[model samples]
Target: MSFLSALRRPPAAVRLNASYRATPCRSVSTSIPAASDKPAKASATATHTISSCTEGTVLGGLNWLKGQAPVTALADEEYPPWLWKLLDPKVIPDDGPGGQGEKVRLRKENRKKIRDVQFMKTQ
Candidate 1:
């Protein structure tokens, strides 16, 4: 057939015959065990009592409850700069780090810089 003729649509009869027909779905349960089956009991390697078990013992997991550090409130002197910035009323209006307005302005500035770099590369 010529290239133009080959490019044209196939005969309706050929198209109908070649159309995909899905096979009926069938599910197999080969991996599933019978209802009457019971799981085998796991054998214990060693017996342990609470007193016998150490912090390092793998048989029963670590004793995190007993090892936790006591909860204590931090003093003003111990507070980090970011925490101080949040607490201080004077710093709130200054538009330094941690301010919502400062963050938005910085983001806009970064976007402009990126766009400028991209425009330069294109030129």
Candidate 2:
């Protein structure tokens, strides 16, 4: 079957994604204060920001609880081995280096070739 035919719904039965979990009802008294209620001072904001900002983004797996995720402290261990090549590039780059040098080099080369090209109309 083609791509559209493959995606077409079955006439017999329709499958639905039932991945939702039953959330516990919390008491109104336990709720945190509104953003406006928090202190407007820079120091207060900075401290909160530092605490909230969990370094080394969650990749490869599901992060159900972002605050208390199973993410390792050392990013080098958790992250893909090739990611380092992009972060800290080598002389002769390995796969997925995605180096800025290559783009710059290509752009420069293209401009030079364009300048050198002689059109019959211009001549």
Candidate 3:
């Protein structure tokens, strides 16, 4: 038989379910409160600011339930004057002898080279 003629034929037998249990209905309270009677407020009071420690560094996170805002990171392109002053060694004291200096020096040395792969091919 041709493809079009085969498609027009109906299949053998079809089974159908006549009954099924539907979902249970939820009952709601019909009692209504008076306009003058206010709803009870939250039981426990929240702290606006809470001090916390992270890896020996002191930091603060906000408690939004008390209506305080959280601190955010400064954008990569934006450099504040106070931040520049902070970066200067004379202002912020360096950690003793062999700590952060080596990592900072390595990063500075690596940054001096051209990063693009196209530049690497020329050399």
Candidate of highest TM-score = 1
Across residues 24-102, which tens digit of lDDT does each residue of candidate 3 receive?
Answer: 2222223333344345633434322211222222112212355556433333234343532332345434576665766
Q: Is candidate 1 or candidate 2 better by lDDT?
A: 1
Per-model TM-score, in order, reads 0.23, 0.20, 0.20
Q: Which stretches of candidate 3 lie over 4 Å from their true place?
A: 1-98, 113-118
Q: What ranges in model 1 sit over 4 Å off?
A: 1-95
Which is the winner by lDDT between candidate 2 and candidate 3?
2
Error of 3 at 102 (Å): 1.2
Query: Per-residue alpha-carbon lDDT of model 1 for 1-123, expressed as tens digits?
Result: 664343233434435764532222211222323344345523323221112222332321112375665333343345454532332345325466788778777888999999999999999
The lDDT values for all models are: 0.42, 0.39, 0.37
* Highest lDDT scorer: 1
Model 1's C-alpha root-mean-square deviation from the true structure amounts to: 30.0
- TM-score winner between candidates 1 and 3: 1
Question: lDDT of candidate 2?
Answer: 0.39
TM-score of 2: 0.20
